[model samples]
Target: MDLQKPAVEPQQPEGCLVVAIRMPVRIVVLVLVVPVRMVWDGLVVVGRFLGDAVLRPLGRALLWLGRVLLVWPLVGLWRYVVVPVGWVLGRLGWVLVVVPVVFLHRYLLAPAGRALVWLARGVGAGLAWAYARVLTPVGHAVLWLVRYLVVVPACWVYEWILAPVGRALAWGARGVGRLLGLLVSGVGVAVYWITRVLLVLPALALWRWVLVPVGRVLAVVAREVGDALGHAWRIAGHLSRAVGRFLATLFRWIFVEPVRWVYRTVLAPLAHVVRDVVLRPAAEAARAVGRTARQALAAARETVRQTRADVRRALFGEPRERDAVPRREPRPLGARTLDSSTTALTKLTKD
Candidate 1:
């Protein structure tokens, strides 16, 4: 056995030429796309910052200004001016046009229409009387006269003189129709065969023997070309993404890491110092001032209470002995009452 040749032919997904073209093309595409992706990423970052930090607040301010400047004034005008004007116009319309139209329809047009309808009914009654009493008898006499003078002779002529001649003519018509049908059928058959032989057979043979095979070949070529383009695009996309990842890593190392380090080492300490040295002292001072004011208020309250007691002692001649009040009370069996304030939270009123 000669081992030089294989038993089966090897198949490859694509040719060597396609691979040769695809690799360099992918590299070129990656090179071209890296800068564009970087720009897109930077723009995305900028747009996010602007939208979150600047544009959103600006948009809110503009919306508030628009409401204040345009919307509120318009709403006030519509409510205070336009609404009253419209109500006045509606009342005027009801008084002037609608009332007059209603009056005309109710008082004038309704009676006129009713009178005209009644007159029409009287005329119709007169016509009905003429038809029932006078026209009916005259119509019957006229019908009898017409039957003898015109209709009876016409009917007799149709039955005897004209019917037999019509029947013969109808029989001739049937015979002529059959002959014409036969001639047309024969001509139709010949034309059908002639058309089939000249046009249909050739067209069918060309479609079956020539055009179908050519279409199949063209379809296969188009499918392969489309598949090749798809594979190239997919490979290019992978390469471009890889290049973009590499660029992102490079940018992070070169720019973001140093910025983060600076913020952590430098700016964070400054912020902490400001908080501890300035903000904390200011907050503590505010609390101290609040405590002084609260003490002053408590002293004033105690002074007022003592003054009220002194006044009572001076006017009402010495204080009486205090009475002990019970904290809890008993209720009747199966009877319950609801109160606004809880006895545990507030002092209950004595009866």
Candidate 2:
């Protein structure tokens, strides 16, 4: 009496048995998530270092006390007294709008576009120098008086009269086509020698005595019936190439060696075990999520270019910089001893 009953095993997936029983409680919550993400990134770097050391120098001392109490007395009452009273009312509004546009571009728009481009380039250089000196020598003296008066008297009346009345009507139509081709070749050579002397000499003596010995006995009985059908077409082409190499070695040992041994033993090792068990761990988790989204878009474009260079150095205060070489202002020690006594009295009046 056989009684054994156990063997069950294969059941797994309750989310893979709750991820293999919470893999050691996710390695003790990844060892307390790295000291709680380093104390929440050290309290977001001490709240961005107390908003960059106490709200950026108390917002640059309230934008330098609102640009020293409202932008330097309205930029010194618009650069010293409303820019010299709007530059004397814009030079009395450009002497009432640019002296009538410089007296209509000096007397009427530049002498009306230079008298309409010098009367259209002096009427196109006086119609191209009257068509090169008086209309090309009055059109070559009216085409030399219509080629010497009316085409040299109509080519001297078509070469004296009409070219000898068209060469006497083409030499009387080639002498009436060589007198009707010598009267139809003398009545076709007198009806071909009167039908080769009445009919063809008794049909050429009855085809040289009856059909030339039947036709050489039907050409020797069609050359012995074409050499007995070329020896029965070369013994049926060597019995159809030995039954086509015995049906191509019985179709390569019955169907190409069991489809090349089941593509070399089962579909090339199940396509290299589904490309090393599923496409190399999904291409290394899509290249670690595209290198953590290109390092968080290069740390958010280097924290928006250090918060726009700390708000343009806290509202334009540290900018100055430009001094290449421009200081001048120092003349008078009696204008350098009166420019060295006018360069020693112009080098003592050029010696």
Best by TM-score: 1
Q: Over the stretch 117-179, how does candidate 1's per-residue lDDT look in tens digits?
A: 999999999999999999999999999999999999999999998999999999999999999
Where model 2 places Cα greater than 4 Å from the true spot, the runs are: 1-22, 32-34, 41-53, 64-66, 77-82, 104-109, 112-118, 128-351
lDDT of 2 at 279: 91
Candidate maximizing lDDT:
1
CA lDDT of 191 in candidate 1? Answer: 100
Error of 1 at 27 (Å): 14
What TM-score would candidate 1 get against the native?
Answer: 0.56
- The weakest ten consecutive residues by lDDT in model 1 span 1-10
